[model samples]
Target chain A: MKNLARYIITRLLLTIPMVFILLSIVFVVLRVMPGDPVSSMLGGHAPERVIEQKKEELGLNRPLSIQYLDYLWQICRLDLGESMVFKQRVTKAIAEKLPATIELTIFGILITLFLGVFLGAYAADRRRTVQDYVIRLYGIVVYCIPVYWMGLMLQLIFGIWLDILPISGRTSPRVFASTFEKTGLYIIDTILVRDFSALGDVLIHLVLPAFTLGLVLSGIFVRLTRANMLDVLRADYIIAAEARGIRHKKIVYKHALKNAFIPILTMMGLQIALLMAGAVLTETTFSWPGMGRLLLERIYLRDYPTIQGVIIMIALIVAMASLVVDIIYAIVDPRVRY
Target chain B: MATILEIEDLSVHFPIHIGTVRAVEDVSLNLEEGEVMGLVGESGCGKTTLGFSILRLLRPPGRIVKGRILYHGQDIVQMSEKEILSLRGRKIAMIFQDPLTSLNPLFRIDQQFIETLLTHEKGLHKRAAFTRAGNMLESLGISPERLLEYPHQMSGGMRQRIMIGMGLILSPDLLIADEPTTSLDVIVEAQFLDLLNDLRKQFNLTIILITHNLGNVAQLADRITVMYGGTIAEVGEANAIFDNPLHPYTQGLLSSIPNIKLDKPKLKTMPGSPPDLVNPPSGCVFHPRCPYAKDICKVQKPETFSKDGRLVSCWLYG
Candidate 1:
């Protein structure tokens, strides 16, 4: 336990500088880019006095070094400033929207995990058979189609054609609950109050968007799980396990599956970062208010503060997730610890 | 005194795209309980194939085409998957060729050993299983604390000992050691073989030692079988076989061993390469390389006949 604590502490200490460099680079690059943020947010034809006043207000009129120092200071203190597009404090904006994006990502990942691991384990159990072929074929078909197109198609089929689910937004219109409610995420608010009808409506609304997002990830997870499981099967200990007459399912799950998932956990963490990056497409298609779709809109409007804020936020999330993965890896296999 | 394993008319054929290769052709052997039999053959002479055949670990493309591998009195070939599995680690376990690759590198020693124990002893409590495993490790002259380490942390000899420990822990009726010391250095190899011999006697274990080293057989085996080109060239009590090898191939093999004669020239080697399994020479498999080859030797395969209380597959004995 002491060794694990030391290892984690060492890794955390090393990450401090890396986080600083990452945030610094994003902040400086956004500042250096040739854009009049004030004009872009308000109007390109705004008067010079008004533009100058906006620049001073945003601290853009200061020297580069001063601006960098101020940026670093704000970052160190966790004062992320305000969103240019929304005219809201950055922390407030994130607190409101972050939960929705996080919830969606979590649901999508859970779906991927449950289905992907099941399929992979099943395929390995029936290796080289028709069941294996069919599972692999299904993964390939789902993987190749674009997530946005899948979302639209699902919306068209399930929502528009069948009238089984909502087409857009988070909840049903009859709920009459104002969108101003600060539950941050609609699904959680409904579930917390034991509102089954509202929860069902939220799930029905979530299906098209979450499926669209999860389909590609599910394919990747299945492929990774299958590969790792196959590798574990070929491991000498597994052969030893078989030679010992341990029941087949026990061999598959206890011996093969858990060992197989060690590497997959690391991959899953990386995939989380990739999924967040890809969620831009899903959020745009579904009109789900999340960092990704917000990033694209902010980029178009030249809302430099919002774009920079979101990019920095993503970089930090990715770094943190990767750090968690390394910790989990050491926990899973103590041999990995130095 | 009682038969433990009996192999009769065993032939393992490997099918290639071009043609089928007979890896082990009509080889037969018998083992009594608490006996150590050494299978001595040059490389590629099907020693390992025979070993895998006993374990039924021969995978696709290579198969036991015709054989009765009778463990106790029941034919293993007729056993179902579940029945075979039940017998595998409990009755017949194999210590593989390479100790390093034979262990799972990703697992700790405790995990591997405890799992091995549990796999064989179903419903065994985890604490009791680990205790037995630790005891087994200690009995193998390993520190019980080493169980916390990984395979990569141990030396080759240590890993080999662990493999032996794992095989012996179950107290199986037959233990197949397939060139278990081939990957170790000379000192480690000799130590490992000695350790194996000691463990066998201590556990009253039945051992089938497979190796290319004739010297290994001379050291430990009660009986030795010399295989050449997928067939047993000779079989006898170790002392008699070493002293009076009857077959030409066996004579060549024994004579190839360096003697301490100052005046003697370099040891003589068998002149030709091993016959290709895909298209083996007719009659005696060793005919092309046998100095005493005759017309009948090229046309007729010799039958096993007894001479001096030993079996020799040669025309002279026939």
Candidate 2:
């Protein structure tokens, strides 16, 4: 236990430098790009003297080294600065939008986990059969199709054609108007406030966007899980389990799947990072009030602080997730240690 | 002695894209209760396949094409999945070749043992099963406390002993040990064999010890069955077969064992490799490699001829 704790601490400490590097890269890339906040803010029609004065007020007219150090120091103090576009604190905007993105990501991960593991195991169990071939085809086809196109198709089918589900936004206007916002996550807030009807409304609105995101990612998982399962099923221990008179179901799940899951768990951490990237397009297509949509809007408005802030948040999350996975891996596989 | 296992015309084949690899073809053998039978063969000569087939554990693309594996009058080949499950571990257990790979790496030793016990012995409490496993481990010279450790924590010999304990925990009527000590060092292998022998006597286990190393079974097996190219080359009493190997293949195998007594022994290897089961040599499978091969040996397969209460499959016997 002590060793494990030490391992976790060491792993966590290592991520600090990683985050620093990522922050530096984000800082450099944002500055190196062919645009400045002042010109974009003034619609490129402002006088040179007025633009220079605006740049001076925003501290952009300072030396590059001074600006970089100031930016780092501000981030050290947990201040993301004010967004040029919203004229609000970047941190506050992120706080407001992060929960929605997180909720969508959670649902996307759950759906991906369910579809990937189940279908992958099923295909492996019936390898070389018609079912296996069909699943393989599904994995390829789903992965090949663009995420936005799929989202649009799903909206057209479920939203316009059937008119059974909402095509845009996170909640119906009536529910959004009545439900008191607590966490900015409608599902959680509705449950906390004991509003089952609102909860259903939130979920119904969530289905299309989350499914579109999840279905695209599930393809990678299916292939990963199936390949891992095939290898695990062929292991000598699997044969030993069968020889021990253990039931087929128990052997497949307890023995084979447990071993197969380690690799899948590692893959999951990577997919979460990918999920955040996918959420940008997903949120844009649905006009969902999430970090991705917020980031897109800020990018269009050249809100450098907000863009850098969101990317930093995402990088930190990806790092933390990978650390958690590594710790879990050490726990599950005895051979692995610090 | 009562016949515990009788395999009649058993043929296990692995069908691939090229052709069917006849791993075990037209093989017949019988085992007496409380007897240790040594199944000797080269690599890919179907000895391991025959061992796996007894419990019907042959994974696909390898399957029993035609056979009747009768255990105490019940045909294992004809049994349903449920019946086979009941028979396995409870009635017949197997210990695979590589101890490292045979045990699940993630599970603790006790969990592996407890699961096997709980699977066959229904209504058995987990605690009781755990205790039983600990006892089995104790008897095998392993500390009961070590049961909590994973397979990787233990040495190769220790893991192999745990496998043996697991196989015997259910007190199965038959145990198939396929190259059980192949992965152990020389000293560990000898210790493992001794432990196995002691346990066999204690449990009155009927073991089919499969190995290419003739020396491994020399002291343990009462009867010896020599196989070559997916067919039985000879079967006889261990002492008789060792003293006078009837079949040319058996003679070659016996001579190949290095005699340490000679200061500089001239070890003679067979001229060619084991036949490819995908397309085995016609007539006698051993004809191409057999130094005494004749025209008849090339054209017609030899029949099993009994000589002095021994079965020898060679045209020379005719």
Candidate 3:
């Protein structure tokens, strides 16, 4: 237990420099680009004097060093300045959009865990047979597909072609007005208010997008888990368990799957980082009002403050997710703490 | 004594890409009730495969092509999967080579033991099962408190003793141990053998001890079966095999055992490697390595020649 505390403390301290490095990169990369928010907002039609006055007001007329120091100071204070596009606080804009992206990733990952592990364990149990071959081929094929293309195809089929599910947006405007906004997530909000109709609408809208993201992510998990489970199933302990005449199901699920999932948990953390970055393509395609779509609009409007806020937020999330995975791994296998 | 295990013409094969790797072929042995039968052989001689075959635990592409593992009058090789499962752990239990790898690393010793006991005997509550498991371990000289610890937390000898305790929890009719002492030091090995001797007498257990060490066999075996190239080279009393080895392979193995009393500069090694199971030699699998190989030894497989309860498969004896 003392070892775990020390391990966690060391990791937490280490992330400080990592987050600083990421912040420096985000600040420099945004400034390196040749664009100004004032001109982009005015679209090159404004007078030079008016632009100069606007730049002065926004504190962009200051030297680069002063700007950078000031930016760092504001970041330390959790003040990300204001978004030029939304004309609101950058932190507030992100806080609103953050929940939607998180919700999607959560649902997508849940689906991935269930389907991937199930299929992988099944394939291993039926190894060397036709069913095993077929499942493996399917895993490889899906793994080769690009997520954006898959997401678009899902939209085309489930949205435009079949027209059973919504093509875009989080929910109908009626539910937006009627549902209580306790959690910012409409589904959760609806449940909190016991509003079934709004929940149905939100869930229907979530299906195509979540299904598309989940299916793409599941390919990786299927192959990883199948390989790991195969290795675990052949382990001497599993054979010993079989010799003890324990039921085959108990051996697979209890012994083999438990051992196999350690690596999977670590991989899931890495995939969470990927999912945060990948959500830009997914959220934009679905017209979901998430941080990724906000990022796109802010980029077009040269809203550097919002972009910086979003990027820093993402990097921090990735780092924290990895930290959580390490903790989980230590807990699962006590040898790791030592 | 009546026979506890009767292996008749047992041949276990592995269907590799090239062809069948005949890991264990044309082997026959009989284990009398309450006797310790030591199966001695070098690595890849199919001793472990033969042991696994008794419990029907051979995974593909390794399979029993032809065999009769008769317990009493019932052929276990022909028994249904469910019937075999019932027999395993309850009637015939086995201890593996590496105790570290043979227990689930994720679970505690108590959990593993309780699960094994409850698996064969259902409707048994977890607490009662744990008590029985603890008693089993305590009987094997391991403390009951150690049951809650993980396999990694224990020393190698402790884990091995726990495994032995687990194998005898239900008082099995027969116990098959495959190189149980290979991973232990010489001192630990001797202690384990002593424990096994005491346990056997206490439980009235019949045992099949599979190993390459002649010393281990000399310590505990009532009889011995020598295997080479995946087939039986000789089968006889421990005293007879040690004193007057019949087959050339047995002679070579006995000669290879190093003697500390003599100032022998080099330990003897058999001239050639064991034959490849996939494409073994035309006649005797040992003919290529046997100094006694002749025209008949290279052309025709020899039949077993028996005399006074001893058997040897060699043309010289035939």
Q: Identify the leading candidate in terms of lDDT.
A: 2
Which lDDT tens digits does candidate 1 get at residues A91-168? 666666677677778788888888888898889778889999998887888778888888889889988899887767
- Model 3, span B216-294: residue lDDT tens: 9999999999999899989999999999999999999999999999899999988988788999998899999999898
The reply for model 2, stretches above 4 Å from the true place, is B263-265
For model 2, what is the C-alpha lDDT against the true structure? Answer: 0.91
Residue B102 in model 1: lDDT: 77
For each candidate, report its DockQ versus the true two-chain complex: 0.43, 0.89, 0.78
lDDT (Cα, tens digit) per residue for candidate 2, span B54-125: 999998999999979999999999999999999989999999889999999999998999989988888999
Weakest lDDT window of 10 consecutive positions for candidate 1 chain B: B259-268
**Which residue pairs show collisions in model 2?**
none
Taking all chains together, the TM-score of candidate 2 against the true structure is 0.98
> Which scores better on DockQ, 1 or 2?
2
Q: What are the TM-scores, per candidate, against the unseen true structure?
A: 0.89, 0.98, 0.97
lDDT of 1 at B113: 76
lDDT of 2 by residue, A1-338 (tens): 89888988887888878878988898888888878788788977899899999888888989988998998999889788988766699889989999899889889989998998889988998999999999999999999989899999999999999999998888888766344689888888989988898889899999999999999999998998899999999999899989989999888877888899999999987887888999999999999889999988888777888998998888887888888888889888998977
Fnat values, candidates in order: 0.42, 0.88, 0.65
The CAPRI-style docking tier of model 3 reads medium
lDDT of 2 at A148: 95
